[model samples]
Target: MGLVVPFEDKNPDKGASIESLVSLVSADMERVNAMILSRTGSDVTMIPEVANHLISSGGKRLRPMLTLAMANLAGYHGDGHVKLAASVEFMHTATLLHDDVVDESDMRRGRIAARIRWGNQASVLVGDFLLGQAFKMMVEVGSLRALDILSSAAAVIAEGEVMQLAAAKNTETNEDEYLAVIRGKTAELFAAACEVGPVIAGRPKAEQAACRSYGMNLGIAFQLIDDALDYGGTSANLGKNVGDDFREGKITLPVVLSFRRGNDDERAFWRRALEENEASDSDLETAIAIMHRHRALEHTIERARHYGAIARDALELFPKSAIKDAMLETVDFCIARAH
Candidate 1:
């Protein structure tokens, strides 16, 4: 399927805003928030301090919100979803803490990274602490199937991180390899988050699979847009410095495409900047210019739109409802951020 029609044309009044989804899950999110805060506390003062540093940062909390919304859409009527949603957020936060350390990032949500503030040792240990809390909350939920799904996702996400590390600065990384990396690191948790909604609600296996597909595709689209934004977006929108990827020698799709389309001299430039790690201050500007010349960022966004269409289509199994509409609009909202 293609992405031709704009979200506004499809829903003139609502458009493609996440506010609708946020509002749909607001009450459940309040409980999720409470659970998150309660679980973050620890006797070791540094744990809560480091964890809260990133937790209080102004993230949209989209993954947990998805869990809450999907559970509501499946007609759940219990407190299990609140814990599951909070678990999702904790997993996401933990991933961020660990990722910042791995990526050697300096900023998160426009503030100094927890690793930079507290040091890498503290950041990693607190991430481990959050993972422990997440599993505790998951076990409390009392669903073997849900626990299995999320626990497997944690392993998959770790594998994805290792895969990305192996491929880092390797200009030979292909589209297929990159896709596998994202599926593991980013999409698996999203899939698990949405899938558990139907499991807790006692919905059919088919419904559970559908939500999994929705979350997986939406996550792929989300990451693609994020990678593109590294080149084309501003720091205000990204919550981190633009061109960080280039400076760090990340082998993103934009770099891959530009490397393939560039001439010998341009390829040499990429190898020096990305592989050899010899980028000067002006190199980031050159990287952006090359990506723009080859329309790498634009094509990356097009690929995101493609996955977004699949995410929207995955919801065709469900009947019409406010929650379903909000979910569909959320796909648009994610893709629209690139513009």
Candidate 2:
């Protein structure tokens, strides 16, 4: 349960390209930090440690930045971007808090996961607090439509989580079921982040729809790449152990693919793992071999590339701002992470 992400130079194609996006989003994130920190000055002393653990854990803050970038590209000019951006971050953080508990994981980007440090109860309570904070910030945005999109996304994310719990260790889970889980867990919020800019900035319906589609596809691509990485990536490079999903009996792409490729004996092994008890490392190793034989990892990567291309194409509607360029580069950046 206790493993930390490696601290080293991963260098996911680090040039000077994303500096502008980072620069633009950092102020809003700082504002959020201040808002979060002020509670420490109030009576909630424990709030500081839990909140600080998340903040200092060194996440990319990608979701919130996407919201802000979409706002910029869509010609937004107000504090609503800040509020919505913070809202996106809080929602993302809440998911992480919950995810750690669900996975029984004790490490995130080289730090003890919150659930490990403070216990599952603390993690769940903190997650609920952040969810409330996210909604409160959304209300502060003063846009009911924005609120609707985010709330819907949050609901879908929760549903996806439950679906995964049900799907895990179930050999019957197919590509579509797996895709549904990915869409709910990842794409829905991404769509909201991308869609909010157009909504707040008063973009046309078509434009908003385009942004939503673009984000949805991009999020799927990102997760597919993440799934691919789990099979082929080094634990040191990935910030978590390779094949950890298999170890935990997660119904991931590779595992599903391996099951499909398995013969009668192989199917029997998987059935034992799912129906009997947890799988052993040898079971995991053999499963990886079967998946490799069936090229599941490769298939997932190809799909990721397809979605990355789609995400880039969605940007074609824009007339090309620096923000747009950065956004396009980000799509490329996401795809490149797996390479």
- RMSD to the hidden true structure, all candidates: 4.4, 3.8
lDDT of 2 by residue, 153-176 (tens): 999999999999999878889989
C-alpha RMSD of candidate 1: 4.4
TM-score of 1: 0.95
In order of appearance, the predictions have TM-scores of: 0.95, 0.90
Which pairs in model 2 have colliding backbones?
5-110
Q: What value does the lDDT take at residue 139 in candidate 2? A: 94
Q: Quick one: best lDDT, which candidate?
A: 1
Off by more than 4 A, model 2: 1-20, 23-29, 32-42
lDDT of 1 at 186: 95
Q: Residue by residue across 1-339, what tens digits does model 1's lDDT show?
A: 011211112222234789999998998898888889999998999998998899999999999999999998899999999999999999999999999999999999889999998999999999999999999999999999999999999999999999999999999898999999999999999899999999999999999999999999999999998898888777777788877888888899889899889899999999999899999878887888888788888788888888999999999999999999999999999887776
Candidate 2: minimum summed lDDT over ten consecutive residues — where?
A: 1-10
Clashing residue pairs in candidate 1, if any? none
**Whole-model lDDT for model 1 versus the true structure?**
0.89
